[model samples]
Every structure is written in C-alpha cells, then in structure tokens.
Target chain A: MKRRNLLATAAMGLLLASGGAFAQGMDKVKACFVYVGPIGDGGWTFQHHQGALAVQEAYGDKVEIQWQENVPEGADAERVLTQMALGGCNIIFTTSFGYMDATNAIAAKFPDVKFEHATGYKREHPNVSTYNARFYEGRAVQGHIAGKMTKTNKIGYIASFPIPEVIMGINSYYLHAKKANPNVELSIVWAFTWFDPAKEADAAKALIDQGVDVIASHTDSTAPLAEAAKTNGAVIGFGQASDMAIPEYMPTPRVSSIIDNWAPYYVKRVGELMDGTYAQVDSWAGIKEGEVEIGMITDAVPEEVKAEAEAMRDAIAAGTYHPFTGPINKQDGSPWLAEGATAPDGDLLGMNFYVEGIVGDIPQ
Target chain B: MDFGGINPVILIATLMASAVPILLAALGETVVERAGVLNLGVEGMMVIGALGGFIVAVQTGSPVLGFIGGALAGAVLSLIFAALTQVFLANQVATGLALTLFGLGVSSLGGQGYNGIKPPPTEQLLPDALADLPVVGPIFFGHDWVVYFSIAMTAVLWWVLKATRVGLIIRAVGESHEAAHALGYKVNRIRLMCIAFGGAMAGMGGAYVSLARVPQWVDGITAGAGWIALAIVVFASWRPWRVLIGAYLFGGITVLQLNLQVAGSVIPVEYLSMAPYLITILVLVIMSAGRKANGAPAALGQNFHASR
Candidate 1:
C-alpha cells in the first residue's frame, strides 16, 4: 500500500512537468518575410532584405529566417501567408501597402501568428501591426537642395501612384523647394508603376527634354539617375530608395538620396516575439527614430547649400523643425495650416490634395 | 498645354531606338512560325539575354561582345526547348510556357549580384557633323548600330523568305512536315535551326534594352516586351517588313503619349497609358478581318512522329 502511494505522486509530478514545457513554447522562433519585388531590384526590396539579414544575425541559432521574393499582392499573397502559417512561422512581415487586406485577413484566420504590414494603415485584428517610415522628411531635404541647385527654375517629379503617401511626399518636396526659391516651378508626371526601369528612364528623358534642370522620383530604380548622368551635369536627379551613385556619375547628377533603414525595427520586433512580449502596435518611425535617412550629399553642391541642408536635417531629427509647418495653403488656394501650426497625424495620414503652386489635378 | 518643346526630329529618333527590340524579336518569331513551330517562350529567352548581355558588358567593357554573349545564351536556352519538343515529342504550347517560367527563375537567380550595374556605353554609328544636321540629322544619323541592324535584318529576312531555295524548303516543311519528309528534307533539323535563330534574335532584343536604351540591369527587365513581339508577329501575318511597321507603330504611340504627358496635354494619364495596347488590339482586329484565310502555318503546333 505504501509503494502504490509513492507511484501516484511521481505520476502527478511528471504530468506537471509536461504542462510546463507546453507553456514555455518551442525552442526556435520561425520568422518569415514576403517581398513584393525581387531582392535584386536594388531599391525597396533590397533594403527590406537587409533588415531580414539583421534579424538572422542578431539571434544566430535561436531564430530561423525564411523569405520568398516576387510574391504578388493579391490572391497569391493570401496563399503564401496561409502556407507560411501552416509551415510553423510565428511571425510574418508583408512588405507593401497593397498587402494590407491580405495581411489582416490572414492574421484573423491564424490568431496565433503575428503579422506586420509596411506602409499601410489597416489593423482590424489584434495580431496585425502596421509600420512605416516618414519618407516625406527626407523629401523636404531633397526639395531644399533641388531649389538651390536648379538653374532653370523648373523642377520635375516622377510619381509612382496617386496614393496619400506619394501625394504627401510631392507636397513636402514642393513646399520646401518653394521656400528656398520662390521662383521654382514644379512639374509632376505620374509613372503609375513602382518599378519599371525602362519607363522610368523614358520619363526622365521627357522631363530633361522639357528643360527641367532638377529631377526627383518616387519610383524604385536607379534608371532616372542613369538618364540624368547621360546629360553630363546638364540635368541633376536624386536617388529614390537607396544610395545609387555609380562612381562614373558621382557628385554631379545623383547629388543626394533617401535611404530606408528597417534593420533596427525588424530586430526589435523579433526580439519581442522571442521574449513573449510581442504586441500589435502602429510604428511610424522617422529620422529621429533612425527609420528615414538622407544619403551622402555630394561635393557638387555648393558648401553653403550642403551646410544649409544638413542643418535642416539636424533640426528635423532634433524635433525643432517639421516638414509640414504652415502658413501653407491647398492647391485651390484655401488655408490648410495656420502660421506656426504643424499638421496633425490624422490629416497627414489621409493627405490627397496638392498644396498651392503644384499645377495639376491629383488624378482621381 | 505647351507643345512648343516637342521636337518632331527628336521624337522620331527616340521612337526608332524604342522599336528596335520589338522589331528584332518579332522578326525572329516570324521565321520560327514560318518553319511550323509556335514557341511562346520569347519572354524567357529575352530576359536571359538581358542578364547575360549586362554581365558580359560590365565584365568586358564592350557592348559589342555583350550582344554576342546575349545571343549565344538565348540560343543555348532554346536548344533545351528544341530537344524536348522536337526529339521527345512534348506538347509545344506547354513546353514553351514551362521554358519561360524556368528562364525567369534561373535569370533572377543568376542576376543576384549584377543589379544596379550599368552596361558599357554604345556610341552612335554616324559622325557628329552628319548626325547634327538640322531636321533630318537627329532622325536619321544619331541612333546606335542596333537600330540599323534591326532594319537590315528585316530586309534580309524578307529576301530569304521570298527569294531563296532554303526559304522554299522551310515553307514546304511548315506546310506539311509529312510531305517534306517524303521529299528527303530533314523536317526536325530545319525546325531546330529556326528555333535557335528566333531565340538569338529575342536575346539581342533584350540586350538592346539593357545595353542601349535604359542601360542598366534589373530583374524582369524585358517586362512584357516579348509578349508584345508575339502580338506583332500575328498582326504582321508572319511577314518581316510588316513586323517592322507594327513595331514602329507601337513605339511611336509610346513615345508620343509620354511626350504629351510632359507637354501637359489634357488627356487623363491612365487613358494615355492604355493607348498603345488599345491601338494594337484595334489594328490586329482590322488586319484579321481583312484576311479571311488564316496566316498561321498549317502544321504550326503539331508534333511530328517519324515512325507514324
């Protein structure tokens, strides 16, 4: 009878030990990434891939990273997400605005899986998070340089799409350019694609032929800079998603650039997942948080001009300056922001109208 | 609203450069179809050529050698399709599509480290004084050698298809492979040669985009240019000169619409972007309606069996 009592106690202890193991979760965290374009695009996807590499490097053997490139943003994205969840992925990052609906839908179906969508604003599920960089801050710096650098008093913009994010960038750039040189006339061309090198090059050529001496693009290739390089300093352009200075065309055509830094954010989120402290939240990091960065300003710009641009960058980083400070008006000439007033996040998030002096419809 | 800066001379010059890639690909497809094969892998071959040409150009610093490398890569790739469909007797349509999917994957894999690299510069073939002539100079003399090569290939193909005895054998084979086999002509051999030629031309077209026009490497750089070349072949009724005309028409519309956007014309941007595809469809409809009998080769998609 005493021996039977001891066996019963040992059985109870074994059951409790199994339960504790279940509560502690698996040994390694599986993280997956879905990219909208090939990592060789040399722009947007390439930067995101760098972030994924950082996550792997930070955790070594504790994390397993898997990614699939060139995943289209439609029904195909849903299939990919479902497969990732079934394949034991604990966290998934869908890196494009178009994947917002798919990310939210899949997150609801797999409540245990964590999702992060970039450059989007829908968060219907508790497991879904949204993150974006304040790219317009970098655009403001580009505008200041473009305004000072333009000899023709004309600046051309090659826009990708008619979304609020792109519209805001256009307004921020034009506003800062006009602030520096009131005579600067801005011309906008909507390319309607995020990554087509040939079309992007053609757009750059058309703008140059129109006598616009300064160019800026919202697209995701270095084609525009290459086109500008052909003119041998007659035309100047800024790099779009990364630093695109080919040594042969350096310091002249590609004067400055906007760089997307997503490594720290990825590492942090993965760390949270590993520590069992992961939560769904909206993360909109800017220059201050090291999300948006301005690339090297070449020596081609005058010393005073470069210094002025750097000062503006520092001020934005330190919270002393905002890109949307007003005394600004809408395209229809109505006051949008009063003097000394800054734009609210809500208004900036849904910005669809052009500011005063940008002479074109927003293409509804 | 300003059409003042839209110079006609420069417009035509840009159109000529843009048309060369499509013209070259379509012309090659014309020859392949005329030899009784429907290879839908033009896109696959073109992208492989783009990567191969860019790599060689960056490594060797010679655009000429780059074009040669691109052509050779495309031919080697097409040889795989030729063996599967010609020897193993696989379905041409399915094999062609599989080739395209395989090519896109392989090229993207090979293109990992080659992105953002520029090709060696290609200079204009004509001298400066001649190229700088007032109105005709920009239109006629300023383009690189590839543009002239496209035109030259069109003329040469036209003569080969209509005048040569070898052209007679290809036509005979395309019309009825069984009858050509009876005539002691090697049916599968001729078809293999045509497929290789088609692939080389498509590769050169892709090289033109990477080496001369946009002049950089990007994934899927030959974006849908191959499919458009296929459409041109159909609308041209497999005629080489007609293929040239169709390509130039498409190229002209593309150039004109972009210029209109910059000139600030009143048309909507979306509609202007759709203009080229819409017009191409309309032209195809009209051309098909005028020609009652089908222009496709009688034995186009059929597999051959010597024992049967």
Candidate 2:
C-alpha cells in the first residue's frame, strides 16, 4: 500500500512538474497556521503545532501544512496572511484576537481562500469563519475541583485582561466552585496579557501570600503550575491548554485540561474539499462535541472530590447539567438569573457582572 | 469631575513607571541626537534587552543582575545600528527599521526556551510600613528601585543638557557636526557612545517590563512600547521633565482604563485597551501643531563625516 501510494505521489509530482494539472476538485489541501507566539514556546502555539503535526501525519501527501509563528497583531499579520495566500494556502487559520482585522482584510482580498480566526467576533465574507473552543466550560470543572480540594476555601484566578472571554471563564469557574462548596471564595488577579510567565507567577505568589490555596490561570504559560509546585504539597493547578505540561519544571497539572481538537475539524474540512463541498464555518465546540476534554485526575485530588468532579463532567456531557445554571446572584447579592434560567450564550460571551462567590470589583 | 474615581494619584504613578521605558530610550536618543546622529533602532535594542533580561533573571535568580544583563544586550544590539549609521553611513531611519526586524526574529529564537516559564520573584525595596502609606504610598514608595533611578536620571539629564560644559559640547555637536569635527571633538566616537547608551537604556526599559512589571517571557513582549516611547520623546518637545509627564500620562491612561474595565464600567474594554496608544498619537499630533515645532537638533539625522 505504501509503495503504491509513493508511486501515485511520484506520478502526481511528475505530472504537476510538467504543468499538466492532473485531477480536478482539490488535488492538494494547502493548509496554513498563524501563531501568536513561537511554536517552540512550550505553551499555546506548541499545542496548536502538535495538532497541525497530527494532521500532517494522518493525511501524508494529501495535505501540505505551512505555519508561521510569532506574527504580530497588526499589519504584520496581514503580510503573513498574504504570503500564505500567495504561497497557495487554501485554508489559513489565524490564532489571535489582534489578528482579527488583518484576517478579515486578507480574507476579503483572497476570496477563494478559507480564513479561520480563533476567538474573534468580526466574521464578514462567506470565505471567512470564526472558531473557539468552550474554554469556560472546562474552567467550570477546574473550579469544581478547586472547591472540593481546597481546604483554605480560597481559589486564586490569574486572568488575562478583563475582556468578556476571560471574565466568562472566571465567572464559570467561580460558579462551579461555589456550587460544589458554598464556602469557596475566589481571589482574582488580571495579568493583562495572554502570556507573561513572570506576572502570572507574581500574581500567584501574591494570592498565596493572601492565603489562597488553589491557582487557576487563563494566560498561556505554565508559570502558575510551576509556582504552585514550589509550595511542597499544598497548592494545585489545572493545565490551561493541553500543552501546559513541562515535565522537568513541574509535575502533571492536577485537574483535567481543555484540549483543542483541530484534527477532526481539519480532517473534515479536507474531506469536504476532496468531495467539492468545502465551505467556511464558524465552529464553537464544548464538552458535548469532544473539543473540550477532561484528562486523568491527579493523585493530589481526593477520592470523594474526584468522584464529584467526574459526576459533574458526566452530567455536562449527558446534557443533564450546565455549569452556569440559574439561581445565581451577582457579587453584590443581586439576583442575576432566576432559578432554572441557564445563562444564555450571548450573556456568557458578553459577561460583565460577577457572581456572588467572587471578591473584588471587576474594576472600572 | 470624577478625577478621584479615576484615581489620579495611581494614574500618575503608573504613568511615571510607564515612562521609564520611553525615558530610557529617549535619554539615549537625546545623546545620540545631540551628537548629530539618529539611531532609530530603539525598538530592536529594546526587544534584545527584553530577552536578555528575562533569560538572565531566570538563570541568575536576581532582578538587578537581570537588568544589567538587559543593558549589556541592548548595547550589543545597538552596535548594529552604530555600525550601519557610523561606519557604513547607511540611512539612519531605514537601518534602524532593519535592526528592529532583525532583532524581532533573533530575540524570538533566543527567547524560545525561556517562554512559558515563571519568572523568579522580585524583591521590593521599601519597608512594609512605608509601602502601606496612603496616596503617596503607591506613587512614591512602592515602586522597585529602577523607577526612582529613572526619575533621578531625568533630573541629571536636564542638568547635563542645560547646566554643564560637556552639555555645550554635545549640543554643539548636534547643531553643527562639521564645526564640532573642526573643533577636534571625536564626532563618530561621541555619537557611537550616545547610540550605545540609548540602546542600553531602551534595553533596560524593556527588561523592566519583563522583569519588574509584566515579568514574563512572551513573544513581542515589548508590544510597540518602543515606538510609543519614541513618540513620547517628540511629544515632550525633547524636554526631560516633559518626558516624565508624557510617560506618566500614557501609563496612567493604560492603568486607569484597565482599572475601569475591572471596575465594570459601561465603556467597552476595547476602547480602554486602545485609549493609551490613541492618546499618544493625538498628543504627538498636537505637539507638532505650531510653526517651528521642530524643537529637535538641526543636525539630528545628518551623518558626521570627518572628511566632510
């Protein structure tokens, strides 16, 4: 089979070299990835690269993936996109918020190319689409674990900006923790960036000094985990992206992680292209869709706590429960949603009000 | 009316701290410009410093040593600009831009391994009691030593530029490099030293963000702060005291807007996020309004050739 595939590839290569244009309807799937950070950064971009590698291994000659990491947020983003487009990338995935305007602009310029931007709202042309994993849903599980495991009743949340996305994660985590253990209190610190290991660590230290036991961060670094590990046996953290594990620096992140399964999506798109049904899509997948997965429960987690967390996870998957179901109150004790009124997707995405269990202002 | 809610005191403090990166870059540029040389490679020098300080601090476990490492890295990176502008007599602006592009790539590669790791803890200098004092506490006492030194450097710079004989020589060099060259001042040497110094300070400012403020190893961590600082120098009309005001104002806008977002105000966080940069641009536009707004040295961008 391998020999036959190689021969076919050789034939195709020869035909293409002769400029004969062999087969119709997507002869090759030219895919590109744009990273906000360096691929070797051992964080967010690393994980995305892992997914890209998985696709390359799976598809072989059928797929050609090219990636440019550390492309800045503005005009540079447009330049990289144009370069990728001119290089014959049929599908380009830009992975940053600052890349939103640039991606849209480039997508308009190259009408045939499919542009997918992660965590951006402005999706214009039929060629452009937006996709984001339900990271907040996973944060709920992390909060649940923190609530059950923390003896101090104080869980520290290191956030990246006060944007609705980060705010939503903070609220979801707090809501779940508050549900599991009523005494659980949240100590939040906004680090103001997607990646800054030092500030993330300092925020962790500052929270620990103030008597918080568990640490959670939305920033794209393992600084919180490393900081948590230094405290002998007390502190614990969950992996942010599935890529957070740096074995030499720290042990496994205790709670589960939210993994982005771009493979299935990528593969499906490639399949569509092969069948002449390729189209742009704005996809937001959660636990129900398997994009967000809960990993092995670490030994640091107590048995009872693990059982409760597993139950919650199961309920979420079964559609019998939601992390942000109602009867919740704002931090100021005002009723946010009446009983049984699950917070809608719109509210979740534009979350401005904090729930009852949190301390400190969202800060104007 | 609601200036109290805006927390002007905290705003001012943040602005001052924010100005450090710009002040460092500007001070170095001030010297270079004073010597009739324009080294526009501030951004490159800064990024090199960002990685250098981050790597050293992580390795040495000392923020002070990390800062020194940052300055050295800046100086090293500046030599590229120095070589191009001085020896090759390349177009200063174009060469500086190339330095930035090259620095971005080199620093990304140099900083690869250091990414996603937590920075070593920084030690605060002020005594706990003093650090806790009211409005003055955070503004005056709570900053790391670098903040104080930045302020002190501004004063020293003002004195050097206006009150000293050496200042006269530097000013003379900027005004007429040919004349300074005829008067036997080592034209290229002085400009080289000033360019290197500017690079070092810019690097130190970059280090402060990585080591003191944000203190993380992220790609493009300087995040256009170098450009903003460059603009601040012009906005301040090249005055040392005004540099402090400009830096603090920009910083204050950044911190206040973030604070407002956290406070759950009605304003969109996006606007707040962009407010500082937009304000800086606006300030620059306003500063350039009057005729004779070119407060800069007449020979700022001109190359000084010993033979010419």
Candidate 3:
C-alpha cells in the first residue's frame, strides 16, 4: 500500500509539471511594426521587415507579429498605433521621423505597452526607446570605392532630403573620396523623395550627363545603377540596398551593405522581459556592431585598390579609424578643424554644411 | 546626354512604356468631359485604383483580377462623387476635392500590406523581334495591348462623339439639359454613366501604374498624374486627337529628360529633374493663351437640373 501511494504521488507531480510547461508555451507576446514606406520599396523599410521576419522565425511559438506599411506621419499614424495597442500589442515599433510625435502621444496613453521608434530622436516615458544605424559609416566605404575607381575625378551623389542623416552621409562619402583622390569632385543631386524610381533615375542621369564617371545614391532604387549601366567603360555605381543583387550590377555595389539588424535588439528585449531585466533604452551601432557589413568586391576592383579599401575597413572595424578625421573644411573654404583635429560626434551628428570637395548648394 | 552608348531602340521603347499611364488617364478624362462633367478628382480616383488593383493583384496573384478589382473600386469611389453632385447637388468643385482627400486616406489604409514586393510576372502580347524594330515598331506594334486599346479608344471616342446617335444624345444633354429634358432625355442618367466611365478609366490607369509600369505597389503611387490629366483636358481643347498628343507629349518630355541624364547631359540634376513638369506647365500656359482658348464645351463644370 505504501509503494502504491508513492507511485500515485509521482504520477500527479509529473502531470502538474507537464501542465505548467504547456501553459508557459501558450503564453503570448504581441508585437507590431509600422513602416513609413511600402515593404516592396526594396530599401530601408523592406530591410526592417526582413529583420521582423527574423524575429518571427526565432520566436515561432512565443510571439505574434502584425505590420502596417506606408503609414503616414500624422494623426492617422496615431489612430493605427492606438488600434495596435487596443489589439493587445505588447510591443510596437513606429519606423520614421514623422512618427516621433505620434509614437510619444500613443506611448503616454498605453503605459503597459513598450514603444520603439526608428531614426527618431524623441524617447519619452518609461516605455519608449529610439534606434538608428550609422549609415555614414557605410557612406565612408562608398566614398572610398568611388574615389579609387573614378577616372574622370568626378563622382555623382543622388541624395533625397537634405536632412542631417543625408548630409552626414554626403560629407562622409566626400571626405573619404577626397582622402584617396585629392582632386575628386562630388556633384550633388537632390531628388527630395524617399522612393520615386522616376525621380531617382532622372537624378542619376543628370549626374551621368555632367561627366560623372562613378555614381552613388542615398535614395532607394537600382535606377542609379540602371543609369550607370548606360554609361561608357569607366562608369560604375553602388547599390543603395541589396535589392540590386544581380551579378552584373556588382563591384560598385562591392561593399556588402549596412544592414539594420533589429532582430537581435527585439529578441534581446523579449528575453530580458522574460528574465525580469527589461528596461527602456536608446541605442546606435556602427562598424563595432555587425549592423554594417562589407559585400564582396568583384574582379572589377584592382588588387591594390581592394587592399587599400580593405585596410581602411579593417581599421574602422578595429576602432582605429574615423571617416571624418582632422583637417577638414566646410564648403565656404573655412577650416572646420585645424590641421589634424578630428570632428566630434556632436558636430558630425548635426552636420549641415558641404565639405570642401563638394560643389553645389543644399537646394532649398 | 549619352544616348550614344545606349541603344536607340531601348530608349524609345522605355519612353512609349512610360506614356501608358498618362495615355490611359487622359483617354478616360476625354469621355468625362464629353459628357460635360469636369472632374478634378482624376488624381484621387487613379491613386485609389492603383492601391485597390495592387492589393487585389498581390493577394490573388492575378493581374486580370487586379484590373477588374481596380475598375470596380474606382467606380464605387466615383459613385460617391456622383451621389454628392447628383443627389445632394453639391458644388462639383468642392465635391471633387473632398472625393480626392477621401480616396487618398482610404487607399493608404487599404494598401498597407502590399508595399515593396515585386509584382507577379505578366503575359506579353508581342514577340521580341517585332518589339525591337526602329521607329515603326515602337510607335506602332511594340506597345502592350493596352497601348493599342488606348489608341483604339481614342478613335472609338471620336466616332461615338461624332457619328453615333447615342453620341448626339450625350452632346445634346451636355449643351442644353433643359432642352434635352424637353426632348425626353434623362440628362442626369447620361451624366452619371459618363462620370462612372471616367472613374473606371482613371482606375485602369492607376492599375497600369501598379501592374505594368512599376510592377510594384507603393503609397502615393500615382503622384500627381491625375491633376495633369485634368489640366490636359483643357489644354487639348477637349479634342480626342489632341488628348492623345498631350499625353504622349507629357510622357515624351519625361522620357526625354531621363534619357538625357543617361546620355550624359551637363545640366544640373535638380533643374533637369523638374524638366517634365515644367514643360507640361509651359505647354498649358501657351495653349491657354491662344485665340481658340474658349474652345472648351460651353456647359463644362456647370450642373444642370431641368425642373421645368
């Protein structure tokens, strides 16, 4: 009788343990993604969706993902976010600068929900966090490639908005290009749109017509590459995003890409929440983290040129290099830094002026 | 610009393809104006059709279904314009403006999911060799069937307006609704049908933008082509042949500018980029200032109610 009683107790304990495991497995965390552009824009937001896909894959059984694309930066965004919160979204990401206010307004109303905004500065409340990438670092890589490859000493840059982010990239690209080819000149073309293939193509062609032998674009599209392909033997271009992964479109797109790896951040936060260590945080990662990557340099790049670019990339990865180092000047020919005096993070983050090697006004 | 390195055949082909959107929209508007309803909401209608067709096509993976869905979506949205102007008798201008704002919001809401992905491949009508011929091929046989349909539509519209008895009735209603009512014609009914047809065409144009041209969906995809089409109606003096010329001219400028950039023009990128829109505006101004400026249908933009 005693042995039988002990066996029954063991069986009951096993049943309870199994039930607890099942309950844990069924517990759900709701997550939502709001995008500024369509998922097929083949650029910024598309890559973010890819990161979200990674999160979905990793947390297959534990989380639910909902996404809204082409969300404008106004009251409609606020309404959609409210719907997300009401729908039981425990974590939400609003991706765009215009979404900053809406995110904060919604965050204040839903204290239980955690909010994250991409490429935005405002981080209010205990639940709000801001995140962005060091795209300028990748721009430095592009600058290096354009500088070494251009035979005309003229490089064209197709830009979107003249915002700090874009300006920082232009300055970074020109600084590095000028370092390698002292005589290199950058002609600027602003398309003023995030994703218009027609506009992007037009801007790229404008640059090509002006005798620019190499092209780089801050706008999202392979239109610039399409423009480059039309140019003569010396013309080359880089991919803004990996959307131009076609083999023939390489070399200029040589450096891989600065991928926005939001998966690690998302998963890490979720893990922290499970462990009772979650906290609101704002973060930025550059070459140190794996967010920025170097794509394969094709046979088009000369051996010595590849070696020099690789050395610079290595130094950047090892924290020994800075793209905007000493002896730089603003477009007005005023010395921005005394010889050998590097620019500070504060200045670089707020950069609005063209560097010495760049020509053309930041068209109003 | 460097068309020297680029194939002339390829350049011309791209230009004709670009003309498809404008051609579709303008042809639709020509019918609308023929019935004496001046809709400034073509842009709005086109965008909604773009979003609707794109969403359906992406969901069903059928371009035909996308086009049909787009036409229905457009017709429904136009019914709102019809109801306001027909039933409520609201100011046509204000109602059209409100319709645009409403369509933009609705499409933005409906089009959230299908962004950024490449569209499913569509079937082509012509073979490569025929498509690759020089001037004759591109201007005639190289286009998608829609291009041919648009051309055929222009001829059909011209015949319908000039030769058909139904055309006489529509023109009669447009010119003097009270007189047409005395003659036993339902002016409102005819105008309503014309408005719906206009909406469908605009929607089809929007679908073309999503399905054939860009072959992808995005927010604000139509941009401002609708507004341009509305303007072109007046610029073309409301003639079918003129509408075709205006569309190709607008389309050609856009294509030519891009080609110049590709061929390597020395112009500033900003200025060259604005070339298409600037040229369109210039043409409109020049045309409008001419002695025949008053060639628009006399009853255009005027709502008629024949209570007598």
Candidate 4:
C-alpha cells in the first residue's frame, strides 16, 4: 500500500511538471479566494464574492473557483492560504488590508503559485501582487452631493479605524464637500470598527441628534443608511462598499453610493494567468480604469446638483479633474499642495492627516 | 471644542437603547451561573437569535413575534449544550465552545436568503405625553418595549433569587450538586431549566440588536455583543442589579466616546474607543479586590454525574 501511494504521488508530480499537456491532455486552473468577512456581509465581502462569481462566469469550465469566507486576517489566513496552495490552487486572492503580511509570508513558501492581496501595500515576494481601488474618487462624488443637499450645513462622517485608507477617504470627502459648499462643517465619529451594525447605527444617531443633515461613512455596512432612513428625509447617507439603496429606502436615504467593481480586474488578471503572462504589478485603478464606480445620483438631489456631480464624475473619468487638486493646507495650517497643484499618488497613499478644515486630530 | 449640539437627554436615551441587549444577556448569564453552569456559547446563541428573529420579523411584520422567535432559537441552541454537558456528561466548557462554533456556522447558513433585509419597525412603548417629558421623558420613556423588558427582567430575577424557594434550590445545586442531589432534588433537571432561560434571554438580547437597534439583518449581526454580555456578567459579580449597572456603564462609555469625537475633543479617538474595555477591566479588578469571597458559584463548570 505504501509503494502504491508513493507511485500515485510520483504520477501526480509528473502531471504537475508537464504544464499544459497531461496524460489526458486536459489543463485546468484552480483559483481560490480568502475573504475577511462572510460573503453575506452585504457590503464589502458580498461585492468581492460577486467578482469571484464573475470570474467563473467569464471562463466557464476552463477555470475553477473556490473561496473560504470569514477567514480572519491573522495566523488563520496564513494557514488557509497554505492549505489552498497545497490543494493545487494555481492562484489565490487574499482580499483585505489585514491580510498583507499573511499573503506575503504564504507567497514565499509557494513560489510557483501567484498571490494577490487587495487593499494592501506590501509585496515581499515576487509571486505576490497588490491591487486596490481609488475609493476616494467615489468619496469625492458623494461629498459633492452631500455638500449641496445638506440643509443643516453639517455633514457627519462615521469612520472605521484611523488607517490611511480610511483617512484618505475622509479627507477626500471633506475636501470635496468644502469645495461644493464652503459653509459645510464636517463632524466625524470614529467607531473603530469595520462592520458592527449596532455601533454604526448609534454613531449615526448621535450625529443626527447633533443636527447633522447629511452622513458619509467609510465603514462596511448598511446600518448608517438605515439609520438615516429613520429620520424620514431629514438625514441622508451615501453607501460605502456596495449599492445599499434597498427598494424600501431608495432615492432618499441612499442618494448615491461608491461601488467596488473588482470583476473586470479579476477577469483580466485571471486571463493573464491562463496565458502565462501574469506579472507582479502594483495595480491601483480608479474611475478611468472602471474599477471604482459611482452608483446613480437619484432624483433626491436637485437637477443642477446632480448635473454638477455627474460632470465631476465625467471629468474624473476623462482624467481632467483630480480630487486633490488644491491650494490645500494641512489640519495644522501647514502648506500641503501649492495653488492648482495636484497632490501626488504617494502622498494620497500614505495620507494620515486631515486637511485644514476637518476638525480634531487623526488618532495615532 | 464645539459641544453645543450635544443633548444630555438624547445621549442617555441612546445609552439605554444600547444597553438593553447586553443587560438581557448578562441577566440570563447571571441566572445560569447562579445555577452552576458556565456556558460560553452566549455568542453562538445570540447570532442564531439575531437571524431567527430577523426572519420571523420580516415574515410576520411584527417585531414582538420576531423577538419570540429569537428567544426560541436561542433556547433551542442552548438545549444542545444542556444535553452535551448535563445528559451525556461532557465537559461544559468544551461543549459550550463547540456550541458557539456550531451556532455561528448554522446562523450564517440560516441567514443566507435574509441578507440586506430590514425587520419591521419597533414602536415606542410610551405615549407622546410621557415620551415627550422634558429631560426625563426621552431618557426614560422613549424606548421600545424590549428596553423596559430587560430592566424588568433584572428586577424580577433579583426578587426571585432573593425571596423564592426555586431560587434557593437552584443556588443549592450550584453550590454543591451532590448535596442538592442528597436532598432529593433533580440537579440536571434544574440546570436544564436554567440553561434554557439563559438561552432565551440571550436570544432576546440578540434580537433586540438586529430587529430594534439596527433594524436590519446582515451576517454576524450580533458581532461580539454576546461576548460583551459575558464580560458584563462577570463585571456585575453575578448580581442582577450590578449587571444592569455594568451594561449601562459600558453603553454610556460607548455613546460618550462617540459624542466626544463629534464634539472634536482633544483626546485620541483610539483611546476613546478603548475606554469602555479598559473601564470594564478596572471596575472588575476593583470589585474583585474589594470582595472577600469570589462571586462565582462553587460548582461552576463542574459536570454533575448522578453516580459520581
């Protein structure tokens, strides 16, 4: 029995060595995904799952997709990635910022396998690639509409942790809102959580009680929108990761949304892998690349305001407008960008401070 | 710097609403521990309750029936732990942990078709006159029925434990199952009942979170609230009234920190976010230090076998 097992292992190893041509002349590619939250989270993970489904839909039987949901972003992620690599998965996508270290560590061990980490920065191994969407671009559009629609001139932001990614979104949203309406005052409530609905709702309620008429969030849930709906047109919110404009609360609470369109990128990368042309590239695509999309700006906004927001979206897509173009100053009144100077990608990627108008310090 | 818009009444009202879920779960845990069973599956039971309550609330269009469904779901999940530890003589702690894992998986599975769905609205229990009372009106009278029910359950549990025979028998069994057994009481039977009660309360707590607080269903909707309830039980020192206080204290800190952030307070937001957990630990340490005896039941976590 031991000899027979060893013989079977040898045969499998031979099959793996002969790249496209096997004894049966069939080649198949297995792609696996690791999600930080369950696919039913309705915000972040749910959208990523849709992208994985798109990959299957694009390739038919030539590609196989497997995903393990709710994989925590620590040691457990490493174990899951390792198991997927051992199970003959040719490529794996670790989809969260927290999986940065785990993806790199696992990628080192599985040199022949390709690893993709989303919303992360590190690429310690040659086989590891990182990709992220410019969610701030969508934030810019939401801010434009928020500034115009808020009757109280007070826009509340429900933030999730003080990471650079979240901070960047906050600053972009605040800046655009300030531009659209200089009278807008931004109020931020840092919930320090990615997806706790009750806490998110309480944050929204607190902001609303304090006279915030418009709300924006960098968290992963529809709770803020639901909380806004409770006010009966007195409060409005923008959806964060997905279009959360459910039929019941549509056109009012969720006037617009920032959607993470990962399908095209996922499909393109998988195509590259199938053709043996995949490379370790740092891809940060945004509006122009069709990675980050702005959901419909419903009739809740006035026609002129909607037109302005649409123009900004078109300008962003046409590469004529940059969200960070400014004579902007730091929160402490230090010079950040000169007049009409566009802030570089490096500054935006490592953004940790709020722009001048935003109150309070970014928690270290 | 800008604290002008912060209203004390609204702040306190939000605090009460936030505290109800934890208070209910802690009160249930208080009873279960008083009867000598240490069930670590509160989180599991809570998630199942959240999903179960959400499903029923959506189908029936009644928040009341939704909460009942949540309690029932929680109780049923707890029965698995009771059978494992009480009937089959399994390790209580291990079985409880397994129950939590099972609950999370099953609840997520049950929640598949229910994502992005909103539950029926829960109305304020008090009339406008009472609910609109200056300062105290919003704080004390503007919550849904579950908020009042949680406090009432604490009071009722306190009365029963202090003045009732059933409470004495349950405490006796918790203190020493062998002695309770020699006294001709059914140890496992009483424990089974306590477990079911704990499960029901936890389910209601979870249901309150999904059906009332957020009014929507998402995966892992309970989101570590059950564990907070467990910590609150310990922080309460196994007393019902203290559990109420502990739950509110945590809730108040949570609401206050968010208020501080919105007011542009100078304190770091991370420190503000960590304040509740730190305060809970400090309170627990001080309470444990001041008390001469540990508040835990004598036979807590010890599986009782009839022959042994």
How accurate locally, in lDDT, is each candidate?
0.86, 0.75, 0.73, 0.88
The true-versus-predicted C-alpha distance at residue A199 of model 4, in Å, is 1.2
Preferred candidate (lDDT higher): 1 or 3? 1
Q: Please give the DockQ score of every candidate, comma-separated.
A: 0.52, 0.10, 0.13, 0.72
TM-score to native of every candidate shown = 0.93, 0.77, 0.69, 0.96
User: Candidate 1: deviation at residue B121, Å?
Assistant: 0.7
**Candidate 3 ranges with C-alpha deviation above 4 Å:** A1-27, A109-112, A124-126, A227-235, A247-258, A339-341, B1-20, B36-308
**Which residue pairs of candidate 4 clash?**
none
lDDT, candidate 3, at B158: 80
Q: Which 10 residues in a row give candidate 1 chain B its minimum summed lDDT? A: B1-10
Using TM-score, give the best candidate's number: 4
List, residue by residue over B31-81, the lDDT tens digit for candidate 3. Answer: 777777777788888889988887888789888888877777787889889
Q: How high a TM-score does candidate 2 get?
A: 0.77
| True contact recovery of candidate 3 | 0.11
Candidate of highest lDDT: 4
Least accurate stretch of 10 residues (summed lDDT) in model 2 chain A? A15-24
TM-score leaderboard ranking: 4, 1, 2, 3
Please give the distance, in angstroms, between residue A360's alpha carbon in candidate 3 and its true position after superposition.
Answer: 1.4
